[model samples]
Target chain A: MLEDIVLGLGMIFTPENLFWAFFGVACGIVVGAIPGLSDTMAIVLFLPFTYYLSPIAGIALLMGLSKGGNFGGSIPAVLFNIPGTPQAMVTTFDGYPLAQKGLAGKALNTALLSSVIADACSDLILIFLAAPVAALALRIGPPEYTAIIFFSVVIIAVMAGNDPCMGILSVGLGLLLSTVGTDPHSGSPRFIFGFYELADGISLMPMVIGLLAFSEALRQAYGWLKRQAEGREEPPVHIPGNQGLRWQEFKQIAPTIARSTGIGACIGIIPGIGTTVGSYLSYLAAKKCSKNPERFGQGALEGIAASEAGNNAVNGPNLIPLVTLGIPGNLAAALVLGAFMMKGLIPGPTFMQNHAQLLYALFTLLFFSNLFTFILGKFLVRYAGTLGSIPETLLISMVFVFCVIGAYAANSSLFDVFLMFAFGLLGLALTALKFNLPTMLVAFFLGALLEGKVRQSLAISNGDFMIFFTRPVALVFISLALAMMVYTFAKGFSRRRHTMSH
Target chain B: MIRGKRLLGLGVLVFCLLLWFLIIPNQTEGKTGAEFPRLIVLFLAIPGAVLLLRSGAATGAAPLKGEELYALRRTALLLALVCVYMLVIPKLGFYTSSILGMAAFLYCLGVRTPLQIILTPLISVGLMYLGLGLGLSFRMPAGLLP
Candidate 1:
């Protein structure tokens, strides 16, 4: 193993690999900085370009791309109060407020610093602990998978929103939406409403862009018009020049970064639970532990650290299940799965055993990609900070166009654009109701996976309701989930009683 | 405002009930398709019932104040415009429809400045053209446009 590691390190320091890693990171930053384009889209677009590179270099390029993209998303979220992707949504909670305070550069730098720290640490964890975790995960059957997922989601629902009922409502609604289109096992369409495009269920890209970006455009427009109604020209934004993170600021958020990185790495190994959930759960944990939790959603630097670190950290360990168990953790990992298969590297237990040297080389390349991200991120942060100076009206208008273009480009379908617009309306309505939109989106993301697991478990048991209890792992998780729900309800009930008396 | 929120809550309750009825007869190919959806809807009805029952206590939620109502109406109008924008895109093509949509959107957003009214759409269209034409190499949908 040591020899393999040594050999891999020696193979990775080549100029061609290093150059591709740098180039991939640079391109990824640009793609992620854009409102509609995402890391997944960037990889799909650039996959063909990696045909000639060695597997180590190719994977390295892809790794750098994802890392750069992870941090790049913060650029827009901070500047515009609009998340570039769902994974960056938590960043907007503190990021946009920080940008409003004329600290956009500082926010970007904090995001970058936390991203590097978490990503590098998580990569180390992936290198050392992947084998054991993968072995453990291999034992997780359909029953266990369903129980674990149920437990996690119930906790997520309970902890995510201002009120527990609203959180559950949002998650329920999301799961319902996920039931649209065809049932995966049945090949039967549920609620297509006669549209052929609904066959594949609702595409994630249109819904995400519509819910976050397009609705944001409309919201900004409304706010701008309201400002005009008040007969006040909006105050010009003050974009600071030297917006880099100071050591003092870094020191303050270091603990939050460390905590969120640990949280993110742990979540990363779980199949189908992606960066968005990791970031959100970490943000929740950070807020819960913080002395001044009220400052979190407003503009706390620690909020930025927790969110960026949590999301970015998942980049490394998310591949663990994919490479070791042939289980793609999320959509992004699935694409990486394709890239691996395309490179003639079939990932499973045998592949890991055989490609130990190459795997170590890929790991080495990823470790260095963090350095490239940090160096290049410094310069890009400056460029992103300048976006604050652009007129809100013009920027909003451009974003509107991009939202349309992005929706169309996703499948080259006008049907997607219409779907995007409909989701935009739904988003606006949810916002008006003050609903927990992120919970809905996340639940929607996880709903299909959860449903499939539960149904499969049932099928295997011949519809026996007690089968879950038969599996020790499943029994443990299901009990934990029920206890969590009961505990949360009890806690909320007591809190409400206390508040009413006060 | 309180009445509006009360109506919203009541509407949700009714919608869930209606959806429950709709799901009853709907047969799916997979064994779990109908069953899983039933479970989700049943879970959903709990919160739906909670909202309905609790609507009486929450009188302050999203009160329909004049400004707030106007904002909602404007948002509705924006949604309507987007629907129209979708319809016209296939008719007038992406470039023409996008420019038209942007101009109208800016107008609705109260951009009275002539320069902004003209420049926002033009600059946006130019960028879109470069992006679609060169970046993705996507062929423009030429409907009525040359």
Candidate 2:
């Protein structure tokens, strides 16, 4: 291990590897800041270039892009309430609210700090715990996946809004929306309603951009018009908040960041769970554990910290399963696995033993990449304050055009653009009606996965529901879901009764 | 009487009924395909029914009033303009439609300054073209801009 580390340090510091790593991170941040584009897309676009480069340099480039892209989404989410990626949707909850209050710099900085710290810690875990974690991850199956999804949906719904029932209804709406495409099981249409565009199911980019970005534009435009009518037509200039994070503030949010990092790291080791769940689950945990939970959706710094940390932490360990067991954790990891295969490198149980020096080089590069992310993120945050100062009229209009482009870019389909507009309207209506839009969005994100897992489990069980209970991990998650549901509803009922008596 | 949560509840109920009776059978085949959706429908309906019954107790915030309603009309107008912009994209081309759409938005938002109006589209669309079309080589629709 010592020799491997020394050799790894030597290989990673080469000019070629260093330059490509920096370039990849730079490109990734730009690509990921766009609404429709994602890290996976960036990886795919750059994967061909890696074929010509040395193995270490190529892997460094991809890993750097993954790390940079993980944090890049928070920039837009902080400044505009528009999530560049779906996982960054959690960031928008508090980050945008902070931006509105002229704390854009603080929000961005908090995100950067937490992201780099969590990423470094998770990378260490990936280096040290890869083998054991991969072995444990293999034990997870359809039943466990289903149970986890159920727990996640219920927890998110219960904690999302004032009314747990309303939140559940929103989840239902999202789940229903998710079932719009052709059924994977029977090769029959479920609810396409004759729009062949939806045969592949509703694309995430269009739906997210419409709901988060476009609807925000409409809402802001309406606020501007209302101000005009009220004769208070002065558009307030958003001054940049104090960019320097105080030591006291850091100390306060440290535990939240640490907890979130753990959650993200654990989730990342498991294949197929993805970063979105890691971030959301961490956000929920932070909110639950907070002394002032009410501050979460209203621009808490810890909220940004938890979300950014959680998502970024997933970047490193997500590769653990891939390197240790040749199993990709999620799409980005799968793309990286593709890159490995393209290089004629097959990672499995004996991969580390065979490629000790190469593995160590990657690990060393991962640590340096975190430093690069920090320096680069600090540079990006410098300009974020200026973005906050842009006038609402211009900003709103520009955001609208960006949304159009983003929706169109996702599938290169004009149909998606129209779908985005429709979802925008739906978002507005839901928000006006007091539904938890975030809960709805999360459910929509997880809906297909949940359905697929449940069906698989049921198939294995031959139509028996006991399969979920028979597995210990699945049983634990199911029990938690049931307990949470009961607790939340009972609390809600008591609150309603108190309100009625008053 | 059927406003706010109650209205939402009724909509949910109607939708669930439609799914159960008409949509599911028409859209899906076999028990395996339909069962998950059926479960989701129940998941939605139960809460929806409870919402319908307890809507008075849950009575969300008050409805939009006077100025808020007037503002909503303007917002709706802007949305209509966006719809028009969408229709024109394939016809007038992506860049042209984007510039026009942005200009319309600025006009609707009361930006009368020519520099801001012109520069907004030029900069936004130029950056978009440079990044997406040039940098990434995305094929933007070429309606008329040869």
Candidate 3:
């Protein structure tokens, strides 16, 4: 192991590997900051470019992409409340509020700091616990995964939205829409109504871009024009918060950051849950633990730290299962798994024994990539305020153009763009209905998978519902979900009772 | 207001139930295909029904003002442009449609500066064209240029 570490360290710090890693981080930040783009797409787009490079450089580039993209996603989420990726959605809860308070710089700093700290710590966890964690992950099956989804959805719904009923409705609405594509189990289309474009279910880029970014643009435009009619001819100039990230700010959020890092890292080691779940769960956890829970969605710094740390923490341990068990944790890791195969490296149980040097080398590059992200992120945060300061007219139209390009480019389908526009209207309606968008988007992301897991679990048990109670892990998550639901309802009831008395 | 919106929510829920339990089942093959959506729809209906029942008990926030309605109208206009832009892209190309759409919105929003109007479109379109088309190699929908 010592020999492998030395050899791996030798290969990683080479000029070629370092340069490509830097280049990858640069590209990743740009791609991730765009509303419609995702890290998975960025990695896929750059996968071919890695073919001619050495194995270390190639792998390093992808790693850097994942790492950089994770942080880049938080930028727009903080500044515009338009998350660049699904995981960054949690960032918007406090991020946009903080931006409204002109604390964009502070929020961005907290995000950057939290992301780097959690990410680096999770990398350490990966280096130490990849094998054991991967073993544990291997034991998780459809039942446990479904229970996890249930737990996550319930927790998010109960905790995040303004109204619990509305949140559940939003989730249900998302699930209803999610059923539009082909059935997961039977491979038959469900609600297409003869539209060929609906065959693949809904494309994610359009749905996400529409629900979060495009709808936000619409909401802003609505607010803008409304204010205009009310006699305010100009939008407020978004002056960034002058309180630069002081040590006191970092110190205050440090504990939350630490806790969320562990949460995110653990979630990442689990297969299939992915970064969005990790971040949301972490955000919920942070809120629950905060003394000022009511201050959470109202620009709490801990909120930004928890979310950014939580999502970024996924970057390291997401590779744990892929490296040790050959099971990719999420879509981006799946693309990396392809890169692993393309390079003639089969990543499984024997991979560690055979390619210990290469593994260590990649770890070395990961450390350097974090350093690059830190330096680069500091620079990006300085300019992030300007992004929000652009004229409302120009900004909204620009965002729209990108939305179109993003939706269209996802599948080269004009239908996808239409879907985005439709979902935007749906989002507007949801907002009007007092239903939060995050619940719907997160639920949509997990809806099909949740259904697939449940069906698969049922199939495995020959249609017996008792199997969920039979497995320890599955039972734990299911119980947690049930408990959370009851607790949430009870809390809401008491709060309503108190308010009625007042 | 809460009670009225509850009816709207109720109407949506009823439509959803029909779509999921009736229309969707007919389109699918077997129990496996329909069961999941049915389960979700069932889950949805419970909360929706509960919300509808409780709607009369709760007094929600104040209603929208006239300016708010005007804003919705303007926002709908912007949204309509998005729809038109999608349709136009297939025939007019991404660049042409995007430029026109951006220019249209700029003027509609009362931006009179030519540089701001023209420069925004040029920068936005060029950035998208180069990055999406060149960098990512995503094939645009067929149009006059492509």
Candidate 4:
């Protein structure tokens, strides 16, 4: 372990790895500052670049992107009431209102500080917890691993937000997509749709680029066109005063930040829930526990702190499941998993046994990446005001170009570009129809893992369905999923009833 | 809104039933040991769809406002621009395609200045090339010019 830590430290300190880490963070910040792009989309757009990099460098880049993106997302939420990432949705509850009050700088500072602090805490937890978790996981066979994946997917389905049915459909679609390539087990072509490119299956990069990045660009363009037609001018960019972090503000929000970070880290460690949900949940918890819950959406510092901390905390522990079990916690981690495979590093139970030094190096890199964000985020946030001032029309078009380029670059295929557009249309249609895209995206992300695990579990049980229930861990997860689903439905029903009564 | 919800619900229900009948059965046959778990998906999807449909019908009763329709139109225009960008990028080269795309977008957004048009497109294209080419090491398509 000592040797591994030493190796880890050495890997991170290297000039090349350090350069990539810094570069990734900067790029992530830029992407996050842009109104439509999220951290996941940014990471996905950049995944192809990592193909040429070493495993440490690649991991470092992604870690930095995740860290920086989390903070960067708050910029738009604070400035224009637009969230760059779903996680940033909570930020807009207070951030934009604070900006309106000429406290944009203060809001940005608090968010950046909270994010860096939360990310650092989460990384510390990951550094300590990952090794032990991997060690324990090494003892588990295929059946156990399979059960864990199933449990994670089920949890994701239940918690994907607002629409469990849409989530299920999304999972089904994701599973169907995952099956398009050559079957890993049987090597049989399941649903290639007579396309040779699909023989290897649809690349996740293009699909993500299209759905998140391009679709968003399209949405923005529509707004731009509408504004033109209605002769509505872009709102003047307001520069706020220095009104940076005050002692009184800090005193109020510090406890909230700490508590939210803890909550965010715990939620992040769980697979499938992702950062967005973590942020919203933390925001709710903070609001509920606050001395002034009514102040939440009216420019409360605690609100921004809780939301930013919650989302940023997800950076470290989201990698926990992926590194320890080779099970990706979300789509970004799934891309990282792809990177690991590309680097000839299998990231499962045996990962530690085979690559302890590298794993430790990854942990160290993750730690340093957060530190980098802590230092750089302050400087970046000072200039974050400029982000809101960029001409929306130009920015929107540029994003569209990037989305196209990103999709085409993924496989160097025009068909993938077309596929992206098709998915964009599907996404837009779904949004118009009021179907929940997050649930669908989450479901799709989990579907393959669910399928693989369930099949493996059944194979171990000799086709017995009772194995899922018999295992204590699996049963606990399933029960939790069921409970959450029931609770969500009940809450929705009561809310509806109350609304009707009112 | 309620009608829309009901329609969506009915669509999901029908879709699930079709999958169960048409897709699942065909895949299930002649597959010996440990077939991929379809039951969980079916269990979740079928009932979930029904529930959603019912809930949607119960909730989606709000009439669409003018603002909502306007927002929808805006969204559609944005989608159209994206489609054009995708189609044009490969044929026109990154710089030309991006500049043209940016100009069109600016025009759509009510930028009428010729200088603004010229400057925005040129600066956008140059910076993009510099960023992607020199900084990120991505080889943006250099279409026509060798």
* Model 4 bad stretches (over 4 Å): A80-84, A92-103, A231-238, A243-253, A280-300, A341-346, A486-502, B24-29, B32-34, B40-44, B47-49, B52-95, B134-143
Interface RMSD of 4: 3.8
Q: Tell me the TM-score of each prediction against the true structure.
A: 0.74, 0.71, 0.72, 0.87
Q: DockQ (C-alpha) of model 3? A: 0.59
Better candidate number, 2 or 3, judged by TM-score: 3
Q: Is candidate 2 or candidate 3 better by lDDT?
A: 2
All models, DockQ values?
A: 0.42, 0.58, 0.59, 0.40
Model 3, A1-502: lDDT tens per residue? 6787799898776889998899888767766765545665566456645655788898889888988888888877876677877889999999889989878778877888898899999888888776565456556788887777677677656655557777777777777777787877677777888887889877766776677667777776777788788997433434445456788887889999999998999888765567888899899999999988999999999999999988888878888867875655666775676567657797765688788889989987889889998988787666654544446687678778777776665466777888888887887777877886766755665666677778889999998979899999989988987887677667766776786677
Q: Model 4 chain A: which ten-residue window has the lowest total lDDT?
A: A434-443
- CA-lDDT, candidates in order: 0.75, 0.79, 0.77, 0.74
Which is the winner by DockQ between candidate 3 and candidate 4?
3
Candidate 4 lDDT tens digits, B73-110? 65666567657876777788767877887777676656
> Judged by TM-score, which candidate is best?
4
Better candidate number, 1 or 2, judged by lDDT: 2
TM-score of 1: 0.74
Ten-residue segment with the worst summed lDDT in candidate 2 chain A?
A233-242
Candidate 1 residue-pair clash tally:
1
Best by lDDT: 2
